[model samples]
Target: MRLLMLGFNHRTAPLELREALAFDNERAAAALHELRQRYPASECALLSTCNRTEFYLARPIHDPPTIEHLRSFITQQTGADADAIHTASIHREQEEAATHLFRVSAGLDSMVLGEPQVLGQVKRAYELADGCGAVGPVLHRLFQGAITASKSVRRQTGIDQGRTSVSSVAVAFAKNIFDHFGDKTVLAIGAGEMIKASLASLRRENPKRLLLINRTQQRAIDLAKQLELTGTDHGGRAWDDMDSLLIEADIVVSCTGATEPIVTESRFKPLLKKRRGRPLFMLDLAVPRDLDPKIGSLRNVYLYNLDDLQQAVEATTSGRRELVNEAEALLRGHIDRCMGEIRHRDIGRLVKQLRQRLNDIAQEEQGRTAKKLASLNGQSTEQAVEDLIAQHNHRLVNKILHLPLSQLDRSDPDASMGFYAAALRRLFDLKDQPDMPMDEASSDT
Candidate 1:
């Protein structure tokens, strides 16, 4: 079987396209079944996250699914034209697919390089696909190996030693501002995508109160409910009473898509007076920041724009470039190893076929000799015939294995052994047989 990985990621597509293609668990499972139906050779698993959407498949090499087939699958599931989105998608075959998956699982592919959450997300996606019965041996082995490789990379490299990115930097800034998040009241402004990611990061700190404040009351309520369901230690509250929520909030993180600032100095001046110099840590993650630039000038008000957090993140990432390079080289080595294993499996199959062919010939010759001896043989003649048949079988087996054995010894240890094994099998017309032990056949070589 040939392995395939096709999808779009943060590097290949913008958030707009990624969001359009994102699949929740139910949708992803349904899509997997649909892909299998559309391409009989495809044994598939769909992985969709905020940063990426990918499909891992194993199919017959002779009838491998085409780029057009993958495009159609995506178009049918997402209602986006394949022609328009195809440029954003990448196609990987066999070794490339394995390498891509390893990097993804290790979080090297993340927008925030080496972020830890992505590894968990990949594991969850694999589990969901496996539970849905959408995964077969090839995909199963590939994902499992990818997970192991990811763990190894993380353990061996310092790539994930620090927090970087707007959300993470915001959380770190919070820690610097407050002794404990559990004692601070958090007010989230707008239900933007980044806000959701920020909340996921913030929730880990077990904040005291997690409040959702959006222009739409329903959106705020929905976010509050989701945060609650995700088992956050914080008590979640909707911002139907926005004034009261704002007045009470100790920290505010805003990531709205508004063209202009949502919270000006004038808006917070009265609230700051009412709180009597109590510090308000405000993170304005919006590109055109949600908070007014003047807010930073207000007393007891700490307002940081996206640029500040971005600078911090960039500094951290720059320091870790060496680790990133090391991690990448490690990933490449793993890809090579996995490909070598796959090639070895193929060679083993070929060897088994060749051995079976010789066994068939030996059995046939022994049957013919026994039949001829049946009419005239004493016990000694029958025994002699059996010995002669055994000797011929040994010679035949030796001749068939000679070339493969030499190649196996001399060929690059990391190169595919399957090609030579397959050649031997095809030449000998050896059909694979059931109930044969691999070690016994391999030992003969």
Candidate 2:
């Protein structure tokens, strides 16, 4: 059996393409089953998130699927062409595939390095595939191992010690600014990536109210619905209602892509007067400054521009560089261990096949000898014949297993000995089988 991972990520594709290829739960599950139909021997799992869309498959295909196969599959599923899919990378064979999975699970491959969200997304993908019966023994083992490795890295390293992205940092800052988000009202000003990310972070605090206001009302409502699915107490209004929400909001994060400032001093001056000095934390995450710079000069207004938050993020990132290195080291060790087990399993399968072939011959000979001995049972010679047959069978067994036994002995000591041992049990139908007893199993190939 072999492992294959094919797909595109933020490194390869832009957000537009990634979003185009995004698969919801139902679609993802269906796509997995369809891929299995196209390659019946393959077990498949699809991972689709904001930053990437990847497919992990475990199969026995002698000529494994190529990048083109993946491209065609994606096109068929999402109606997108090859050109639309960027940075399409493929990993084949055991070691590379294992390493790739390890890195992904450890968050080393994430768009936002060390983000914890991807691990949960991967776990959910595996669960979805398993539920659809699209994951077999190989995939089941691979994903389970990946999940365990991720947990180990998190525990052993400081990769997740600090807030990394603007959204995460914003949420962390909010915690410091206010006692709790549960009682505060959050106003999301746009429906862009940053806004969505911030909303996700805000939801974690179990905020009492979330108001999404976007230039496009439908977009805002859609985001609201999505957040609601994640158990957020969310609602949405049009950009026209921004003034009304602003007066009531305790915290406001604006990430609009407007060419001019969306929230200028002129817009907030009146609201500030009406509110009479209620403290408001405003975060301008847009490139062009969604909130006017002068807004920071207002009384009781704690305004942070993108540069300020970015500086904080950079500081935190520098402090965690050592942790990233440690996490990577942990990931490498896990990859090595998982690959070793896979190699051992492969060898065991080969040994089992060889043993089964020999056992078939032994069974045939035993049947023939028993029939012939029945005819000669009229004489005491039957006892002599039985003893002779037993000796012959013993010699045949030794001769058949000679090569495997020898190879096992000469092979690397730490190499998967279980592979050959498992083969012996499976092929010979051995009851209460013992270890290959390296000395005996490796006598002579």
| TM-score winner | 1
Give me the runs in candidate 1 sitting further than 4 Å from their true place. Answer: 171-185, 188-234, 238-316, 350-445
Which candidate should be chosen as best, given lDDT against the real structure? 2
Question: Model 2, which residues run further than 4 Å from truth?
Answer: 61-67, 83-87, 168-186, 189-320, 365-445
Q: How many residue-pair clashes does candidate 2 contain?
A: 11
Q: lDDT tens digits, residues 365-388, model 2?
A: 777667767767677485678686
Q: For residues 25-133, write the lDDT of model 1, one tens digit per residue.
A: 7888888777777776667887776567898888877785776777787898888767667889998988888888999988787767787767887888899888877
Worst 10 residues of 2 by lDDT: 84-93
Model 2 root-mean-square deviation: 11.2
- For residue 259, model 2's alpha carbon misses the true position, in angstroms, by 25
Worst 10 residues of 1 by lDDT: 229-238
lDDT of 2 at 126: 92
CA shift at 421, candidate 1, in angstroms?
Answer: 15
